[model samples]
Target: KADAKARSSIMLKAEAVSRYPSPAAPLAYGTAGFRARAELLEGVFYRMGMLAALRSRALGGLAVGLMVTASHNPERDNGVKLIDTDGGMLAVSWEKHASELANAPVEQLNQVIASIVVAEKCDAASVGTVLLGRDTRPHSEKLSAIALEGVGALGAAGRDLGLLSTPQLHHLVRMTNGEKGAGPYVGDTAAWNSEQGYYTMLADAFSALLSSGGDRASCSPLWADAAHGVGAPKLEALLSKTPQLQVAVANTVGTGPLNDGCGAEHVQKARLPPRGYEAPLAGRDRAASLDGDADRIVYHYWTKDGSWRLLDGDKICALFVGFIAEQLDALALEPPISLAAVQTAYANGASGRFVKSLGVPVAMAKTGVKYLHHVALENELSVYFEANGHGTVLFSDRATSALLAAKAEAEGASDEARALAAGRLLLVRQLVNQAIGDALSDLLLVEAILALRGWGAAEWDGLYEDLPSRQSKLPVKDRTAITTTPTEERLTSPLALQSALDSLMAECPHGRCFVRPSGTEDVVRVYAEAATQADADALALRTAQATWELAGGVGEKPTGAAA
Candidate 1:
């Protein structure tokens, strides 16, 4: 009953499935996707490729994406995040299918995949294209090629775009599935959606913002720590397109290992200069650090009084909220546009208050960019950020349309204020990476804001002093035993652990604490903040002590634990 092409396709997929057998241990496709050691991911990559191809077909043959990178993970480790048809994380609904396919036995692999095809209502003949990209890792190319083979096995086309940052690949996938045109298209899609187009898009938007604000900035040079990964060359290329700002880049590829004492994670968590900048940093000089794949970024600097200040996602949110609130106020459109900021529980308490002072309600979501992104969609204009410096501002279709309509109506009108506000808002929308949280795009946005206000990192930090906070993770025998409330602001499971931590928090002034299992690692993360640095550090230490006492430590038996 089947044609030669269908049978041949079946054989190809079967053969491909046989080549990479799943590991004995089961793996789940969590928010971070199926991440593990690079060697353990051969089977995962092939199956994910098939999943992405199927996802494309499920969405009427739009291009789905596969990004190969472990982000800030060590160089020896790598993972993949499946970019959905709309250029965001793969649909949460499909995550179950991904996990089922990933952990399926070799003997049942073909049947499992077939069942998925039937369940998703994907026609065998409706094979679609899968766009692939990878970071600069030793084994990334090989893994990406294997994923492409998986795509081919499904009778789907595969396009491997070598060495792209995670967000770049996301942008291109969105462009491929979007409407056709030139620069500045409707909604969120771009006209020229290639690597060059990404740079051109950001550069052009930066120029437009500068023009709208008046002139270029003459601020001090900002140093960029590249994490010695794909972001090094990519950032260089993006900056070459903009000749106005002076940025000194270090820790480039071949200079050091990926995320080895550098990158946004190191800078934000450790609160220290990256590997290359071990020397004393001059006061007033600002710096930005990007993780391996360049999807996350955090800025830091030392004050003149010898104090180091890190402008984390919380700080960035405050600055953007203030500036965007000003722009929205300037436009003052009828019916008034709704604006909000979305953050995870890891966000500083002071940040919530700072934004609230600007009359913008802040919403809290579970950890992970996908969760925050979904919450942000509720507002006309929403800024979402995690404490780790991974997030973006989402402009809804209605919000964008309003701005566009305002711009058109303001044409030849005597309202210069309306015209200028519309111009800045439009450019800001373009400057942001709506597809995902993008580091380079975020850096440019910060720079543009500072230029407009003629302020530096100092002024941004001055918005609100952050409560001292510390994040610690303890290896657990079984991390799943740890759980939290929906907001992750309180621990619900293991009442003893929660009681112990609550007591610890009560001892410190303005103290707050919570614990949750890390999505990507086999450990439970504890976050503690207090009014003073010593109290914050001590509170984090005490929480770990409490957990150890209750769980009897990782290796030892968990004596007092109650599920």
Candidate 2:
């Protein structure tokens, strides 16, 4: 703890010195930042210090910090991002400067930094402070040293809160920056943020559902794979509410995260139960894995005999949409509150139809949460989901007002009337719960719905789930060279993109196909939702092949970045 404090002090001092240095260029922010290629750690850090200094000045001399080093990304991939005063991502527009800083040449970068100092009326030698934090990856420590050097060179204080989870760093950043009170505390759990109001909302809704359904017997257990990121610490706060809810957590300890062996990206293999073919358990044990950031989930459930049945992101969305719709019907609610499920082009066709069948509206958006967040915010959507397991629901003031007004109409209503009204509201709450897109949250939702309907896991998702859907990541060498440069220019031209989409349309019922360059990796992901597993696989592979062919081996080049 003392060592940590000392490092923090050093970083603080370093930050103050670097205030006057010009930033490299503007940093672009996507849902996450355009991840810094792994080999570019030095470049990212130098740029991060500049960006942090700029933000500090922007916020009226508040000390800002940089979380440099990609959490859970590959060894060759690194990221530099800032946690806001409230511990959430900064506004998208703010990242624009960071992107600029990243793209600027060294000479111009120094000038830009100098200019920022002039603009802020601060001496080039006396900028504000910056804090530095890193995780457990082997590269992380070395990266920290280099970043600290940069920060120190700029006369900014660089603190090393060595070996903390990403979220813990987030919390510390908030508190140290005056967003929260000083803890003066150290150790694993002390630094965890208590502002997990979002997760709490989901739990409260789930608890209400279980209570209403007469399934208040006992809270459910949570078996989670945190993927050794920030998830475990944040989830700990959530589990605190329902003490009866047992938690069997794995992969909770580690420095490096987000590898192939852990998280939602890892496929769970089916296990055969003991006692040969006549074993009481016929299928394999099932589990869910969360990615490094803990925002994504991929589910694995067991069959009657114990065989494993994997549930992807789209299926998870479908189950919630369908369940919520029926619950509303039971309460005699009409039009079902105009619920909207926002999906990406990659979502499975059956899942899309299933959501629509539940009497809810659907909107399709470009890949990634940036666009989805905008659409949800603008449209006042009741819910939004992504097939990649990244989603959030909008509890818009308008929607809440509508719900409250409806409740007022139910005042003095009989027990039956109250139940009906409650059911309708519960349906909306369920939509929010599922829309969190966190796997454990999804599991809780599924279990609650099952209890209400008296259905088992298999029966809960409704009719046979249509057909086989398959997704695979195909390498596109030098995908960047084929598209654009300086990172931001990589966007595919509309004409080219539309042409590809048109060709993919031919694979229908065979499944919908789309090409997505990974936000954090080099490979492009191809997804297909078909009427048959074979068809889905073939179509997805073919489309992927076609996309690469069109790119003329652009994606096949060695970008040397980590996923």
Candidate 3:
């Protein structure tokens, strides 16, 4: 009877799927997932639901996660990213299957599902379970229903988490899967799987880190921009729990369109605070911005003289590297764990140099969190962040075990060493959101670190100077013509494009340039940096022109300085 019901469910669901069909041009799951205009994504979401169910079956019924958000994209745009049972991005092999299933025609959808079952050895009778969540987009509720319908078609259990930040959903997926003897879950698995659990965990960690240090009063309040998305309410809730850490949130919920001239993307692109955000008087008045989905953040502050300075992902990684290194030294563990920083080619040249100067090795990954996460996992402790403020610190099981043992041993050590060891180790583990790059968690980390170091945003920004940089997107008729190295540091396709860029870079001091196809959009991205802003802007435009001329660019050449 159960088997028959499952088959019936699939048949009925397949019939409902006819309402949404693949576009004439297939949608490719990019660095994140299927992101485009919301109107074109109903079919994709339905198909994603089906794929999520199959994936759950493939993983022996472990809970999979589906997040409906576009991160920093505009309001009209939406996307779906599948999370594996372990809470990471979907596996590369499965990513291909998802693309295939998403683009499958309406009539062939059932056949495609069958092929996936065979390919993945998914048990049709197994109960598929999926955790679904969405952001604040207007169309999210409707799209989510389509997704649930897809899950129902496969006789899969679906848990609608209502609205949640992207990282919140990722954390819930990890916690749910961790309940299955996956080596002692982080915090309380039950509590950590709920919205309140997430807020409480972060608040508790922040409180602990604050109280561990001498005076909590010394900690400064922050000005935060939530991109008018979900982070505003979430941040408010978190602050309510940890009253010791104060934040005056701007662009709060319902106040503005999502990511409309505010957020990490705005800060990174414009090198200024979001619109309508007023920086508090200079010293110690730090500010941060969370993107639409609250998975990425960029921090900034005004100097005593009122000049604004920004600290992006590269600087974040550098500061964390220094702080972690100091803790490791103070703890004086018997066998030191290896530490490395992971970055993409887009990382500023000065930031990379600063990390190397600290004697920490650096590894380059492709331009995405999953790629960086993979590289970070290779070391005992790895710190990674993209230039656009998407990243988190990763501690391996070995490192976690080592820290725990060290903390245990410190119980008998000198009082000062013991206090330092206990506070730093526990806070390090608690402060970072290991499931993904969480803006709220990262903000707490920055606050904790700033307090510990007795420094303000100005002091942190002083760690390294960012070389002036510019990024441009050129519309290319065929972005496929552009191929890049594994790290995306060098372009290998279109023959002499690299050579042309090399000549252009040579014209400016400390100049660098690279071009690659945008994963989420239809255009190609060009990045350039130099000793000065003027040189960087000029190099970027020239490099973009070269890319357009060589790589089937369709529109008029990009003009003016980089925005």
Report the C-alpha lDDT of model 2 over 419-463, residue by residue, as the tens digit: 555454644443243222344455566556555666544664454
Best-fitting candidate, scored by TM-score: 3
> How close to the true structure is residue 145 of candidate 3, measured as C-alpha lDDT?
88
What are the Cα lDDT values of the candidates? 0.84, 0.54, 0.84
TM-score of each: 0.94, 0.70, 0.95
lDDT of 1 by residue, 1-563 (tens): 33444444544565535779886688888777877889999998988888888787667778899999999989999898899877888889899999998888779877777777666766556678899999988999999998998888787889998999999998888788775311234343444478999998898998788777665454467899999999999999998998876788889998888999999999898888888666546543788999999999998887777666788889888888898999999999997789999999999999999999999999999999989989998889999999889988888878888998898878768688988898898899889898789999999999989988889888888999899988887777777778889889988878899988888778899999888888887778878899998888878877776776665457543222110
Q: Model 3, residue 94: what's the lDDT?
A: 91
- lDDT tens digits, residues 50-86, model 3? 8899899878899999999988889999999998887
Q: Which pairs in model 1 have colliding backbones?
A: none
What does each candidate score in C-alpha RMSD? 3.4, 8.4, 2.4
Better of 1 and 2 by TM-score: 1
Over 4 Å off, model 1: 1-13, 179-191, 216-219, 280-284, 555-563
**What is the lDDT, from 0 to 100, of the residue 37 in candidate 3?**
88
For candidate 1, what is the lDDT?
A: 0.84
